[model samples]
Target: MERAFVVLGAIFGVAGTAAAAAASHITGAGSGLDTAANFLLFHAPALIGIALLVKTGTVHANIGRFGGLLVLVGVALFSGQLALRALADASLFPMAAPAGGTTLMIGWLLVGLAALVGPRRV
Candidate 1:
């Protein structure tokens, strides 16, 4: 599990770094790369945590597991929405971004609560 998290973390870290670099080349100062990078960085550790969950066959708590899932979904939607807006020049649903952001916060909170609840013991 630990090793899995490490790999996941590395993947997210690389992606975040790449996005940040691309942001520099985006020309427009407000290109959403920074937003994407920051969120990816934020979720890097969560990826590790997810790996840990996989290894242990469990999580600190069910809530944490659910939270991690939510976080992943939230990041995807939030970042994807911005990218869509940038590439398509249309928002489709501008509100989706904020909704995703809200899910991220809730997911983080659930993870924290899971930590407080402690991991399951076999």
Candidate 2:
């Protein structure tokens, strides 16, 4: 699980960087690519940190794993749709971005809950 998160984090980080560069060079003002890049960049490190925390026994593994999965799904939906719209004028679905945003929020909330409710040491 920890290894999976780490791999995902690295992938996200690289993809985010590439998206950011593309946004700067290929996208104009008001392009959703920038938003996608921002979301990807922001969450990459968080996912990596969650993996480390889980491996170190600082967080509940199951909860952290679920949260990480949420983050991954959120990123794929939100960023994926935005990139598609920006680059190709397409939509993943009717409300994919909104759904992704909601999922991202839920994922973050779960992470916070994990921190608050996870087992603690003396």
Candidate 3:
């Protein structure tokens, strides 16, 4: 699980940097790319933290894992759709970004809930 999170974090980190560069250099690139990059950059660390917290038993493991899953799915849906649209001028069905955004918000809330649920080191 820890390894999975670490790998995901690394992937997101690299992809975010590339997205940012694309947004800056690519002609006719829209804000969707920028938004996707920001989301990926922001959630990458949070996913890593969740992995650490779960591994250390500092939080409810199940909750943390679920939250981490949500983060991954949210990033894929939200950022994925945006990047697709920005680069290919197409979308991955309707309302994908909004759904992803909502999922991300819920995922973050779950992480907070895990922190509140106990066994925390701090």
Highest TM-score, which number? 2
Error of 3 at 80 (Å): 0.8
Worst 10 residues of 2 by lDDT: 113-122
Model 1 Cα lDDT, one tens digit per residue, 1-122: 35744675777788777777776776244778678778888888877866576456564756666777677768867876776675466674769889889987888787777777777777
Ranking by lDDT: 3, 2, 1
Write down the lDDT of every candidate, Cα atoms only: 0.72, 0.84, 0.86
Clashes of each: 1, 0, 0
Question: lDDT tens digits, residues 15-51, model 3?
Answer: 9999989988882356689889988898888788889
- How do all models score by TM-score? 0.73, 0.91, 0.91
- Between candidates 2 and 3, name the one with more favorable lDDT: 3
Which 10-residue window in model 1 sums to the lowest lDDT? 1-10
> Which is the better candidate, 1 or 2, if ranked by lDDT?
2
Model 2 CA RMSD to the hidden true structure, in angstroms: 2.0
RMSD of each: 3.3, 2.0, 2.5
How many clashing pairs in candidate 3? Answer: 0
